[model samples]
Target: MLSPYKVVTIGDAMITMNPISTGPLRFVTHFERKVGGAELNFAIGCARLGLQSRWISLLGKDEFGRVIYNFTRGEGVDMTHVQFVEGYPTSLNFKEIQEDGSGKTFYYRYQSPISTFTTEMMKDEMLEGVALLHLTGVFLAIDPKNVELVQELIQIAKQKNIPISFDPNIRLKLWSIEEARKVYEMIFPDIDILLTGLDEFRLITGKDSEAELENFAAVYNIRDLVIKDGANGSKLYREGMWTRVSSFKVTPVDTVGAGDGFDAGYVYGWLHSYEPDKLLRFANGVGALVTTVSGDNEGLPYFEEVDAFINNELIIER
Candidate 1:
């Protein structure tokens, strides 16, 4: 159990099976099992980048839970806050890749142990020394009970002056857009750092232009508003200044955890007091690097790997 972690992330921990063939369940011959949770992915990426990241979640007392526990622990993240409950199973997700390299996922996570989280399971000591509290929209959409837990933690973190890094990884599988927008509006003002997908942000705010987005951030009193433009790049609006950074070039194997990688990289840079350019470049570099592998956080590079990648390394494949 690692102590004095820099960040604390809360969300579901689940397994994903990506089918090799694109067809019905009968025709899809092969499937690969891997961890698939946005907050867990962020925690792993932060750990790889040399941060003592603590991930808090509820997992089932089963083999799937063991896989997540062992894998996350192996990544150097502190899972001491993870609560394992009985009678419920862990969540499972199935991924199907389309012909155009797009992905379609089917989640079988109803009544999962992770979704049964409550404030009692998450003790006060978990937020004692953490500088940042990381959250996502998934937690809000998972279950009604999670609302009390999330809002309580948010209030506690605010009282302790701990900033929150929020990623609205919108998922329609668990909830609808209208529901997401309404909950987000209520949760928006408490968030300090907003790392949002541009499309998702647009969908929620109806702000198509960057200027309009900036205004939206200002209205919410968001300290750091980061707009993720996928391959095009990332834009950061903070301290009354705007900065844009380009993404690194890489042939992607899977695009699952790139955004989480970016969140981790940006957090790492911020913790290390990096300049704006360095922060965005490092973030984009990490985001690009994660796409070279299949699993969510498998390709998340180490400290030296990030340096090498950002500095133009030799001609070789990852």
Candidate 2:
């Protein structure tokens, strides 16, 4: 059964082709196909945790698009708002992983189908039962018009009194730091929950101190300021109070979608009204679990799995 809480997010999904062997892409002959995207991963993560997750986006009317659509739908994400369009091609990315599980992606999405999605296509009815509206920098970075679309969506979300969560998820490969900073600043004031990395926060605010982060949150009137520090832990600031949680230790197979899982777990805790400490710990656990498996949303755990993992009851088979 689905949880009463619902999460809605808008972004582009892509067909990711990961190299079968470690090292340079040039030397790899075979690849494995997978579906991946920031918002899509978050939606799948939420769905895995039993939330009614709705995704909004456009995909190319092609084989790859069908694969992505089927995979995401099978994960229990609501597909009512997703559409396939002709002419444009679905986006694709090829990943090159090093021996240590770290990797870089090469994108081939110049003619993205999501570029056709406009603000006019967004309807207020789509957000009717949404408990949270999530956004990310990846969508905004895809196209300049997406900035306006997100702004319009934010206005509608605000009108409907839905809380907004945003993850910068900054990708320098998509845009310059200057460009990202400008766009992020424009969206920051409207974000109620800010989920970002410590490095990203420093980069975005150009401030290195916790005091400055507090002042920035105060300036924006952000209710929840969550910082996700991989491996080290995560910290949360709400109502002028701070809650910190240490990360669970895990050997990562791939670190690609860990942050998205963390976002989903955080949202799940938020909807269930978990205390700050428990929320951060749960989120950190989800993130660590994601790194224990490969693929995009493949490692996103159900509520039961997360519970077991957090309690140190989960056993892995080699």
Candidate 3:
């Protein structure tokens, strides 16, 4: 197997099926299945950009579960630790895409086989060659036991001197705000780069303005903070300086996984030693490209594609 280029991400890997519909209440028309999870999307996004990435998760022994494993393997993800359980169905998420191709998703993931993950499922040897480890808030929402497992995993990485990247990929439907805030506070100190959005930051920190956000970042011992605002561009707060980067314009095909694409781009830049301005621009470019496609991982670009758009040799069509 090839060595990791920079980062390894850990979380649930699900088979996402989005059914075509004219509206939210409409019945399913047809469905398209894709592999998605915040961390998996981040890993795939990194791999597509020529970064050697790995994803650690669990899947059932069912056909759908095998499909997810095989798919990620084909994406060049190192799958040495993807556990397969007996007699459990893979966690699945269903989406209803409106005529405009924007809609909500409903997950059928409670009590999933993957939800049983503990530190035992993850091996110390598996993390040996990785330069960084990426995690998200979803792993925290699974269960208190799983939360403790994730925390232990991060602590291990920290002790091993591997960089830890965190994204508060906050989903209100998964847990209450108070519960989420309590957990966020517990995990913030262990994070190296905190990738979050305006809504999540405000909800977690109870802060409203940029100044308040900045002050919170300082107090939490966060090394870097990137706030993603869809279409409005992104803000980067690092080393006591703040820079705002404008987003690339695109006609969005779907908004799902756009933030994951953003995280992937930012991580790629971080691994490659790009300057702050360049990193933010490249991340926005990746995010804008993801919006033009129907699936989160489908629209992610290779280096050549991103370079073409960045260099203005090709126009980004809506």
Candidate 4:
């Protein structure tokens, strides 16, 4: 049965041009066009798991924007709050993948349509039935104004008693570490769930030890602090206890979007009130599945797929 809970997120979606060859993008002639974004991928991940996922954002009234709109709508994500603006262009990025699935992204998102979005567009009705509001640093890094918008949204979510899940998803290309750290600290107190990468946590707090992590969670009063360590697994801190779960071993084709999938999985488990260990295992399975596929959200598994994969019942034919 599909969960009655609704997961909502706001951010920018882009037309991702992925290189066909596994090398420098300069030498690659053929490319495959697809849709990708941090928050958008999270919405898609939630939708794939049979959660009511809503995406709120602005896009250009261009072909790329239309493609993203149609693609996301097809993924079963609610697009009621997504809009298209004039003049500004839809964001875009080209990916360069190496043999080991590591890659780089070159962004061409100047004057992005999302830049036109204002906090005024955010209304109480938007959170009318939302069970969770997920935020990421990707959107907050796009424009200085977005920080205020996110703060406003956080306030609205808090007023409504909706839990907020945050992922730092830090991108150095978009903003500096100093700038990101400042904004993160300002908002960390309000966060109920913090899903962050191990490296990002270290960079943000200057702490690497598990004890420090627990102390950070306690200081911030965060209910759930989730550390996503790619390939190593995930760790969760809640109620003065820490639970660690191992990652599923998989040969990766693309590493992008795995964390977003993990966020969705963790949120899903949280809403269902899964035990800490089971929650981390479920989230780890989702993240591991994402790395096995090439596209951003294509590998985000359905609940049945995740159950099978976690239970060792899934059979992949080569």
Candidate 5:
């Protein structure tokens, strides 16, 4: 089957590490490495779901950067827009998982090559073929230059009538609440599709009613609004219709990146002309599937996997 649309995503990518041992740090002696970045993961998810995805980033020339670059390339995401810069070290992050499945993450991305990105790096000619532009809040806070670039990209996407998908993957540790709010307000008016976690939405908007959700969408003229509430599933609002889709049952390893995976699934539906219910079901399934494995994108389902899951066909291991 052909993809619903072609996409181009922009943001930072980094090496993610999680302790192999479950208990205290003193006893945890080893760690497993994985590559994760909000936009990067979204690109992988889209590609896995049978879409043409291109991920653009400024990575360091270090081994860590090479690891992400090679892995992303191997995953079938277009890497022509990715540039590995010399003299800058790739970023690293560590995830300390608690016994109860909670995780604490520490980031070391300051001064990374991606933080030096500027608008001159964007490839405008490529936008002609792209069906959508994907972005996250992470890049806006990474650097002032990136903030300018985000605005420029949004404007360009609007001019070309290309849909813009945004996820406010809020990382409070990276920037202050005030800073995040400022950027959100500036871009809120331009977002065509808004994917936000229920918690994050409440945290930012301070309102929990469906009316509040619709009010924001109506005022902003957002065509698609998805509110993801983990475990309980997600709800989508569009064109005066509201649909709630249930989450699939799965034993979650690490819940990080599920939202990004879900975004990919929902965007796939939008690309392929799926009805709202099917879109949410597919998105919820994709989100839950990603949580079955430890790393971010490791559990991202391929087309066959998604098909099997949605069709109620289970694969039993021998």
Candidate 6:
């Protein structure tokens, strides 16, 4: 058996909705509820691939919230830091899936209980057994209190010599570009592994070329940097070496959660000490597979699925 590394994820968890069609003209819709958050998705993705993962967040005292808590716990995720809040509503996101698997997502999340998390709620030992602390920019974007609390969490991780990974999965609906720019500036120096999209790079550096993106990562001294270009593959910079990795050629059913799947796949590769190229391949394979289904996190391939997909045994179609 492989050794397990304790992975810690911090962010908001929500109820996700994805509609599926059953016919050409008339469609029957079915809903699958799961814990959905950028960081939480990454953690769940890691857990699905056999890592010992944990999640920390504030869940509302509601039926929907309890469902999320129970589901994740049942998946073998440690929920030691999850707090049940009495007066707040859990966040919710809805996706409308077309027959071809394309969709639009809407978020209903302001004033969520998770955004109310404060530094006081965290303890030093909350991170005791963590080997890696994973965070998403959405937490910082959601609230100032969460930003401060995340800063504290990062400090604790640093103090304990635990590496930190950041996915600046920026949501333009959450804040103004200027506000996000300032936050990124404040947090860049603290991030170890930085995962972002080409749009994020363009927005952050005002640069359109991969050369400029690589230069930007070098300027920040990030150990592992990935610039994701949707469906076009991703570029990675590590240990002063840069590599352009091609993505799997597949017709996407829905693009949502694909990047999160990529983030999860890359984290799994990092935790398991896979080679750089293999890591990129694994990440891209999972990302491609995710698009074959709907929802923010459904169809996230497990280790077995990933292995089969990468080996070309599992043929994906449009």
Best by lDDT: 2
Residue pairs in collision within model 1 = none
lDDT of 6 by residue, 39-156 (tens): 7777677778777888888889999889988888877778998989988999987666565644566788877998668778888888897788888888888886677888899899
Model 4, TM vs. native: 0.97
Local distance difference test scores for all models: 0.85, 0.93, 0.82, 0.93, 0.86, 0.81
Off by over 4 Å in 5: 1-4, 23-28, 315-318
Candidate ranking (lDDT, best to worst) = 2, 4, 5, 1, 3, 6
Regions of candidate 6 where Cα sits further than 4 Å from its true position: 19-35, 96-104
lDDT of 5 by residue, 83-177 (tens): 98988889888877778866678888878998767777665765668899988998887776777888888888888999998999888888887
Q: Write the per-residue lDDT of candidate 2 for residues 157-247, one digit (tens) a residue.
A: 9999999999999988899889999999999999999999999988877885789889999999999999999999999989998899999
Task: Please give me the total number of clashing residue pairs in predicted model 3.
Answer: 0
**After superposing candidate 3, which stretches have Cα over 4 Å from the reference?**
1-4, 23-26, 99-102
Put down candidate 4 lDDT per residue, 1-318, tens digits, no spaces.
Answer: 678999899999999998988988888999999999999999999999999999999999999999999999998999999999999899989988887867888999999999998889989988989999999999999999999999999999999999999999998899999999999999899999999988889998899798998889889999999999998999998998889999998888777899999999999999999999999999999998888887888899999999999999985432
Residue pair clashes in candidate 4: none
Q: Give the per-residue lDDT of model 1 (tens digit) for 207-276.
A: 8687897788889999889988878989889888999998888888878899999999998888777888
Q: In candidate 1, residue 125 scores what lDDT? A: 86
How many residue pairs clash in model 4? 0
lDDT of 2 at 3: 95
**Considering summed lDDT, which 10 consecutive residues are worst modelled in model 6?**
19-28
Error of 5 at 276 (Å): 0.6
- The Cα RMSD of model 6 versus the native structure comes to 3.1
